[model samples]
Target: MTRIIAAVATAALLLTSTSAFAQAAFPTRPNTLQGQAACAGYTVDNYKERFAANSGGPDVQLHSLCAGAYNYYWMYLNAIRKGFSESDCNVTYDAFDKAARVVTNFWAETH
Candidate 1:
């Protein structure tokens, strides 16, 4: 009976630890600006492919916003890797954030 109890306790401990580790592995939000931009782009692309196929994908406004966000994300990332000043990268980062926000909002509204 004691052995069975010990085994059950061990199993319970393992289950609890596994759940905690899994939760830590997945964050609720993107931790990096580039990650956020990619998420925005993915959402926008999914929307265009799934919902706007008949209408020829996203409208001009959304396409412009999403494309600009994706483009700026890569540019900003490259600039940072190349040792650009934070001040210089700020403008690009803001542009990407703004466009990403618009894309996210549009996606939320449509779905």
Candidate 2:
């Protein structure tokens, strides 16, 4: 009985330690544009709404990532506002997608 209890306690301790290590190892700030990617299928108003949604929350890491995505939306909106062209928005969106992929790869490697 004592051996079993000790084994369980050791397992719990290792689990907690590993979980804490993982949380600490994660980057506090986004390392790639992909981490901030959002608003892909959104219209101008929808994009704005999404940005507003991201404006506040409990998670600081989430807020930072959302801020990056909001910046991407702003670029899309700016192109539209300036009457640049659809291609301009497409370019910005493409960049956002690429950045997101980079971030995804980064996390994959870290894990």
lDDT of each: 0.46, 0.42
Local accuracy of candidate 1 as per-residue lDDT tens digits, 1-111: 344334334433443443221112221222142344334434423534523342455465555545545655555454454444454444455555665676677756664
Q: Please state the error at residue 94 of candidate 2 in Å.
A: 1.9
RMSD of 2: 19.7
**Model 1 misses residue 89 by how many Å?**
1.0
- Alpha carbon lDDT of residue 38, candidate 1? 30
The TM-score of candidate 1 is 0.46
- Give each prediction's root-mean-square deviation over alpha carbons: 19.0, 19.7
On TM-score, the candidate that comes out on top is: 1
What's the alpha carbon RMSD for model 1?
Answer: 19.0
How does residue 74 of candidate 2 score in lDDT? 54
TM-score of each: 0.46, 0.36
